[model samples]
Target: MTDDDDLRTRLHRADPAADVPPTAPDRVSRLLEKTMTTTTAAPRRTTALRPTRLITLAAAAVVLIAALGTWFVLRPDNTPGAPVAAPTVTEITAPGIAAKCAEPTADRLTEAADLAFAGTVTTIDGRIVTLEVTNVFRGAPTDVVRVAQTGDISETMMGSGKFEVGRDYLVASSEGSMLTCGYSGEASSPGLAGLYDTAF
Candidate 1:
């Protein structure tokens, strides 16, 4: 016998279902037709779901876009009135030299001074002196005041004759210039409060 014939004989002898009968041709054809129908139906079902999924996603996108548009239209500006502006800064310069001061009179203070207030010195930085106004004596109301010191201390001012932090002062100014000839002095200086009271 040939080698191929010998191999076929061995396979047949070793086959577990060698005695089982073959399936009928009609039954095999029916099984093949059922399998093809199921496979084709699966693809149709998948294709039908694609449109539904796309429509759902599109509807969600539309809702999101509408919500964002509404929020943009209705958002609060949070500004009630005029927008806030920067703090008003009143600038004044200290006298550089001492001058002969006439006796401080209430009438002179009232006539010459356009601004006067009682304030406590809050800081003395470099050549700048900042004071927090505690009371308004003869001028427009202000919360804070800054004075530019010119290194030279005027003996005309009371108590150390210069601006010092934590000391209360009664200050008078004429046209943005600080008056130093006893018109402006420490609050506790003799007759200073009385002078302001009489002037205002």
Candidate 2:
């Protein structure tokens, strides 16, 4: 052989493949499998809601349902056969009125009248009868209001008697000013007064 070839064979060489651990190929395969499993499971972990978060979502849904139910059931309306409106309670501590009339009910005088009160007739002139307002049930009124009770003013004013001056009466007006049949009647009984305390 050539002298150069012999020199090449004498040179130093390293067996890198021999130094590797025997388990290294198997270990690398196991690590690669673990990495792929972890990566696949990450999508499920991020997408799923935790138990506490699920509970919070359920509670919010329940509260929303309750609130919606309340609003739907208690809405206001004025149609006939509709539920009698809930009474608007005001300070009844105002002076009680003593009037001479009879039989006025909350139901008979449906939800039409805007104002109701027990008052004493101060004067009777033409068709107008001035009254001293004693109680305010559904509206804001001054101490005195003028009303017209024609034909038999006493029929709705109080009892069967004529609307004599200085007599007390119960008046309910739907048109705010003009008094008409049925609703405009004499209210005299203390018990009836209490029952008719609500406006339709």
Candidate 3:
């Protein structure tokens, strides 16, 4: 047989039941058509997400603005309000005593140091008398006096009658120094310096 005939026989024998029919020109045409279709068709489109992205950004910006506004409104003022009133320094005096007695007995008695108070005489032993002055502006007894005299100073100076307990006395002394009051003798008792320094 000829060479061409022999090659065709071998190809036919390799796949005799195969459905693919050999046609060089037809196969070339089909491949060209497929290439044209692919090239001419539009490209797959990516979804447009700009609108959704813009909305999310706008929401975040609104939240930030709201937070800033709230903070500004709630901020405290640096300058405060008016000052408060100080406690009244009311010096209680003896009933019926003239207001002029508020002054110091003498210039040698130092400045008006007697802290006017209203309270009862706590104790009165011979030569030593303790007055428990209360309702004091500053808490606790502000003054304690040790009166040094020849006779009962409470009755002598206060009056000829007896100095009863709970009877209030508006006392003036040499600088509100605490000493045994209503006594008359040469006994020296330590004066009360700062009685209300800590008691208050």
Per model, how many backbone clashes are there?
A: 0, 3, 10
Task: Please identify which of the two predictions, 1 or 3, would achieve the higher lDDT against the true structure.
Answer: 1
- The sequence of per-residue lDDT tens digits that candidate 3 reaches over residues 43-77 is 11110112232233233333423343342233221
All candidates in order of TM-score, best leading: 1, 2, 3
lDDT of 2: 0.44
TM-score, one value per model: 0.55, 0.39, 0.26
Per-residue lDDT of 7 in model 3: 98
Query: lDDT of each model, Cα atoms only?
Result: 0.63, 0.44, 0.32
Deviation in angstroms for 193 in model 1?
0.7
TM-score of 2: 0.39
Quality of model 3 by C-alpha lDDT = 0.32
Superposed Cα deviation of residue 185, candidate 2 (Å): 3.9
- Tell me the RMSD of model 2 versus the true structure: 29.8
